[model samples]
Target: MKKLLTASAFLTATSLLGMVGNAQAATISALTGYSTMGGASTGMQVRVTFADNTTSTGVWSAVDFYSGAASADGWTLFQSGDTFGNPWTFSNNSSKTISSLFINAIAGSTLFDRTNPNPGTTGSAAGWDFTPVSGSSPTSFTYSNIVNLVGQPAVGDLYAALTINWDSGFSTGSNLSFIADTDSAISVIDPSNPQPVPVPAAFIGIGLAGAFLAKKEISRRQKSHKA
Candidate 1:
């Protein structure tokens, strides 16, 4: 009986430890965009990276003027040359469950506008924004009504891309990019800082050792009681 109880206690501790190790948070770095124009053509790239070291790349399409439209669905209004809008969405494809979400955006070589003049200017654009959706349980995230760019470019053509990333509790990485054109190559915009993963092997070793000791102690107690 003593040995049985000791072994049971050890097993319980091991189980609890496993549960604690399973509960961890996920992270997403940010999205970066770049564009260049030569003659009458333009090129652009959008890159996104996740916490687990996964990445996604996208190319931007030809520059188009925006049409005056109100923000609706999951899209937000953004403008650069003329008036252009961008809308974004998110989905989870990892085997491991997700605990949280993070997102960031960087504009290279030019800045796009979301409000005011509506029709954004042609210059370097940079900013970061974050919003939590559905507490902790969310499988898909979507944002629409991004930006609508109106007037056409007076000089060279324009291009842009959007990247999205997420973190899932398991050791997995994923990315998605929305490309407008393919002239530009997607590069690592912002690299993520390395993170440590939980070691199940170590936990298992410690648990087995503890269980053995417990069983030994139980056996000794039983012998003493019988004597």
Candidate 2:
């Protein structure tokens, strides 16, 4: 069964989202005006590494910006429909399963809105806010127990259709030059098979020396008994 897990950044109430601009209307928002009226591209990459040291990567590129909109609070609102992309899949070729996942976004990237309604639905649905990491401006998020993608047929680890959109927080005069890019990695770790430790050569030499001494002592005792 598929879990109802979503990854989002800086999520506000949906009611507040009503004030945001709509792509279909192409109108300026109440909070900010349009700055750039050109198309902007957002790129996404998902990489899966199996326990058998095999990897699978998928990439999706789409025009994310219709026109630039400004805001007083430094937030750029993007409706669910504004940054939609097609669904991409990750196939597992390794003999292990996935345990956790991670996501990374560039600086000034605030919101990571993603949604998957039907298991096969490939569009937007939920929202989440990004928290700034210590000693870094860019943001990174980690999630555990994502899915099982190992020890199955080649296509058994296939995922449902999912989509993601990123809304940025920028200062005034910010333009479409600020691209929304994200990279995700999923990996597997097997605790049942721990790496073995190698024995030191000194220990082996010590054991051989002890055996030689015991053999010599036994032969000496036998000679004394044969007197």
Candidate 3:
């Protein structure tokens, strides 16, 4: 709900994540983080972190995303301190079903409305409903309360809990989400960036020192021969 992210001044790319293994302690990672004025966005509106396996030691883990900010980036984009609901779509196999769904937000009972991804035929979900998403096979869910058929739900302090049995362990995989403009794309976060995330400048300095010493050794050898 606070401390949003902004592109320092750049653009990069990666591949969509593939299905994860059913291995215990399978890691759940944020493949890609973006703010799409017209696409699926992933990440937490509030400060979020991970909890140990929801099942047991080394099993399905809980990505506990919670916090109640009076006001957050419910909507809007591009610029300093921007905000949005930030709906997320983790790596899904299209076969595995989310075992459990939990949502407990104190909305502060404030009137709120947000049509982030879309108004999507005004629907509603009780915080306790495990199938808040509806249907067995689901790729995504647009959480909202239909006050007006094409309006955003009025509420804050959003909460949700989901359990998924990834076919494989959480590793490199593909991700998919919607976007508004053609400029948007379906990309993934390559933690294993083929082009390594650059090293520190201090490391570069050390490398330069090594090269200088090597060059000095050769120069001294030439001078010794003349002597």
Q: Please give the clash total of every predicted structure, in order.
A: 43, 7, 28
Q: What is the overall TM-score of model 1 with all chains considered together?
A: 0.23
TM, every model: 0.23, 0.21, 0.19
**Per-model C-alpha lDDT, please?**
0.25, 0.22, 0.20
In model 2, the worst 10-residue window by lDDT is: 25-34
Please list the residue runs of candidate 2 whose C-alpha ends up more than 4 Å from where it truly belongs after superposition: 1-41, 63-97, 107-227
| True lDDT of residue 4, candidate 2 | 15
lDDT of 1 by residue, 1-227 (tens): 11032333333221211101112221112112222221112222333343444544333333443211112222222222221112122333544333323221212222222212212223312111111111222222221112212332211122122222223431233222111111112232222221222233211222455446434533443454466
Name the candidate that leads on lDDT: 1
Who is ahead in lDDT, 1 or 2? 1
* Tens-digit lDDT string for candidate 2 (1-227): 11111122112112111011111111111111111112221222334333343444433233344422211122222212222221112222233443211121111111223211111111112211222111112111222111222443211111211122113321123222111211121222221111112121111111333234433533443343355
Across residues 1-227, which tens digit of lDDT does each residue of candidate 3 receive?
22311221001111112111111111111112122222121221221112223321111112222211111112111111111222223332322222212111111111112222231212221111111111122222222221121123323212121222222232223232211110111222111111111111111111233234423533443353356
Order of candidate numbers by lDDT, starting with the best = 1, 2, 3
Ranked by TM-score, the better of candidates 1 and 3 is 1
